[model samples]
Structures are given as structure tokens and as C-alpha cells.
Target: MDMSRLIETPLHRLAHGRTGDKGNRINISVIAYRAEFFPVIREQVTAERVAELFSHRRPTKVERYELPRLGALNFVIDDVLEGGVNDALNLDGHGKTNAFLVLSIPVWVPETILQLREEITA
Candidate 1:
């Protein structure tokens, strides 16, 4: 998984949302670690782009946050799940549907990080 290629993939741009904040209409965030990966991550995760990806899901808001010290990017996505925590707990049939929904969306991670993990294991 080359870092450059991975960033360009359609899957990498999935699972994002748009901002509803006044005067700051465009803001987007994708989760990742490592400073080297931020440029590509930031470029692909624009608010407009995110809004398109999650248009069907229709979250209320999306905001980006930098956590350099933790080497992770945090995204605050509002209203992703309907009826919130209580709805989650009252899920039918042992939560398989909810689990499937979560698995359907792709999560982006740096290729360099994957390479490092492979090296460590090898």
C-alpha cells in the first residue's frame, strides 16, 4: 500500500462529513497518524468532499482536529447514528446490523504505518 496511491483511492475519501458551523462552511477531517501523511490526508478530506461521501447518511456536522502529540487525527461527526446511545443499546438481534453498518464504511490509515508494522512483525 503506497502512501501516495492509498490517499488517492476512492475508499480513502469515504466515511467523512461536512461542517454546519456558521462562517466556516468547509471543514473536514479524516483519521490518521504521522505528520508525513497529513498533507495528502488533508487534501482529500475537504468539507465538500466529505459532504458528498456522507450525503446519504446525512450527519449534522463534521469538524477536524489535530492531535500531533498522539499522532492521530480526530474527527467530530455529529448525528451519525439515529436516536443516539439509547438506540444503540436497544438494538435488535444481538447488534449484528449495527456491526455490519460500521464495517461497511472504510477507515483510512497511512501506508507507511502499515509498512512499519510489517517490518516489526518480520
Candidate 2:
């Protein structure tokens, strides 16, 4: 398939994610719903971009770990919890919903992949 042309697509349409928290840190896992979408996600979802996405929280640092075999990406975001569940006044101390924020980032996908995803979802 020709991959020269790509279309803007929401990451949620290509993958699903879950979040976990530890002290002042949150770890989010983005797993492609289909193996075919993994490449598109991996290429566009950068550590810098993830950091930028959570810029409001002023994360100390953002680290991305690639699990190609599992068709997933793990992001460890530090210092976004406002000082952990025990200390933070925030309702989302655990930050379980942060995964959705990460999944909200848009990425460019080849038309072939987009069509394939649409077919599967439909």
C-alpha cells in the first residue's frame, strides 16, 4: 500500500489506553486496537509531544517506553498528580483518566490504514 498520503486521525480511533499512578507519577499504556495501527502511533506519539500535552500539569519529565512486541507504548509521566493521592486536593488523584488525555492526541494515518480501521469499526 502507498503510504505517502496520510490523514489526520484521533489516537483513540487507533488505540485504547489505561492509566496507573504511583506517588506523584502516572503511567499510561497505549495499546493499538489492531496491530496494523501500531506503526502509525509509534511514529507520531513522541515523548516530547506527550510532555507538551500535559504541559498544564507541569510534568517534571515524560518518558516513553516502546513495547513493539505487544503493539503498545508506555508513558511514565512524573509530577502531574499535584503531590500524590494522599496529599493532593485534586479529585483525580490517581489520574486514571489521564490515559484518555494521551489518547486524545491526534496523529496522521495512511489512508489505507484509516479505511481499514473504519471497516473494522463499522
Candidate 3:
């Protein structure tokens, strides 16, 4: 299908993510809300793309591991924490809010695949 015609929507509509951090590295898991949406995420949400999204954090490396059976993707980002929870000066240094940031990334999905919701129309 030609993706050019697809609508861009925040990832939260299709999936949810959680974050865990150890030292300067953070692990995030993006799981599709439905199996049908997995392929869309798998194709668009690459490790490089994710790293780009967090470019301000200056991650040294970003790795994505796929769990097709569970319709999920795990991302491990390195060198983003400034040291570790005990060492970083930021208020949310452990990076728990990073998951919500990831969920806000825009993804293009076929218009037909989306079920228009009243809330969105309003």
C-alpha cells in the first residue's frame, strides 16, 4: 500500500510503552494494542528512528529487539541518563517519563485502518 496517503497519528493510539532504566541506559517496551497494528509499528518504529527521536539525549547507541509473538518491540538506549539514578541531576533522572515521550511519536497508518472515534471528531 502507498503509505503517502496514510494519516499521521501519535503512537499512543496504536500502542503503549513502559520504561526501565539501569545506569545510563534505558529500556522501553512498545506493545501493540492489537495484533493487526503490529506490522505497522514494526515497519515504522526502527531503532535508528527512535534514537533520532531522542537525539537531544545524545544516546550512544539504540538497539531494538523484536518479540513478534507478543506483538512488541523492546528498545535499549545507551548513554542517556548522564550516569545513573543516584548520579543524574534531573528531577526524573530514572527516565520513567521517557516512555510517555516515546508514545507521543507520530506514526503514519492507513486511514482505513483507523476507526474514527467520537472524541477525536469532537
Candidate 4:
């Protein structure tokens, strides 16, 4: 693969995410900034990668649900909250940090997409 045209960026640059919780499980949704960017995000970001990223939290399981029409991926992570909201030690017991942590995931995209991102931002 030609590396020059590929731009390595955190997932946040290509997508935005939100998170919620159900007991100890965290539900995170990642939506691509552009429809064209969805394929790259889908191909690069996998449940395995997410599981690896949250290894410190020791999630029992990670499942990814794809919403192609919405250009989104929803990840259900189990047992990362230290317990349910009432029992969690963190200030944001809903595992609010999960989405930002997931966004830290790195992805490689073509230069054209990078340009599109800049345009969207601008």
C-alpha cells in the first residue's frame, strides 16, 4: 500500500461518538463524518481493536453492530464500569469516558478524505 496518500489520524477526526450504559455494559456509537469515510472506518475499526484498546478496563466482551445506512457502528462493551452506575467509583459512572477513549483509536485514510474533513471543520 502506498503510504504517502494515507493520513494516520485518531478516529475522532473521521467520526464522532456518544456513549451510554446499561448496568455494567457500555453502549458506544461511532458515526462517520462523511458517508464516504464509513467504509474506511468500518474496515479499520474492529471489535478486536476496541477490545484491545480497553484492555486496561478488562472488558469481558465486546460486540460491534454495524449501521451502514447511518454510517455508524455501535459497540457494546461488557463489564468495564467497575459495576453499575450506583456502584461505580468514577465521577461519571455511566462510563462517559468510553466514547472519548474509543475515539482515540487510530485510523488511516486517503488524503482526499483528510481534505474533506478539513473542509467540514472549516
Q: In lDDT terms, how accurate is model 2?
A: 0.90
| Tens-digit lDDT track of model 3 for 18-63 | 9999988999999988777788899999998899989987999999
Name the runs in model 1 displaced over 4 angstroms: 1-7, 10-33, 88-122
lDDT of 3 at 67: 100
Q: Return the top candidate by lDDT.
A: 4
Quantify all predictions' global Cα lDDT against the true fold: 0.42, 0.90, 0.87, 0.91
Residue 71's lDDT in candidate 1: 37
- Give residue 6's error in model 3 in angstroms: 1.2
Candidate 3 — which residues are off by over 4 angstroms?
Answer: 1-5, 116-122
Q: Give residue 47's lDDT in candidate 4 (0 to 100).
A: 97
TM-score of each predicted structure versus truth: 0.45, 0.93, 0.88, 0.93
lDDT of 1 by residue, 26-53 (tens): 2333344344445545554544554455
* Candidate 1's TM-score: 0.45
Q: Kindly indicate the candidate among 2 and 4 with the higher lDDT.
A: 4
List where candidate 4 sits over 4 angstroms from the true fold.
1-4
Q: Of models 1 and 3, which has the larger TM-score?
A: 3
Clashes within 3 Å, all models in order: 0, 0, 0, 0
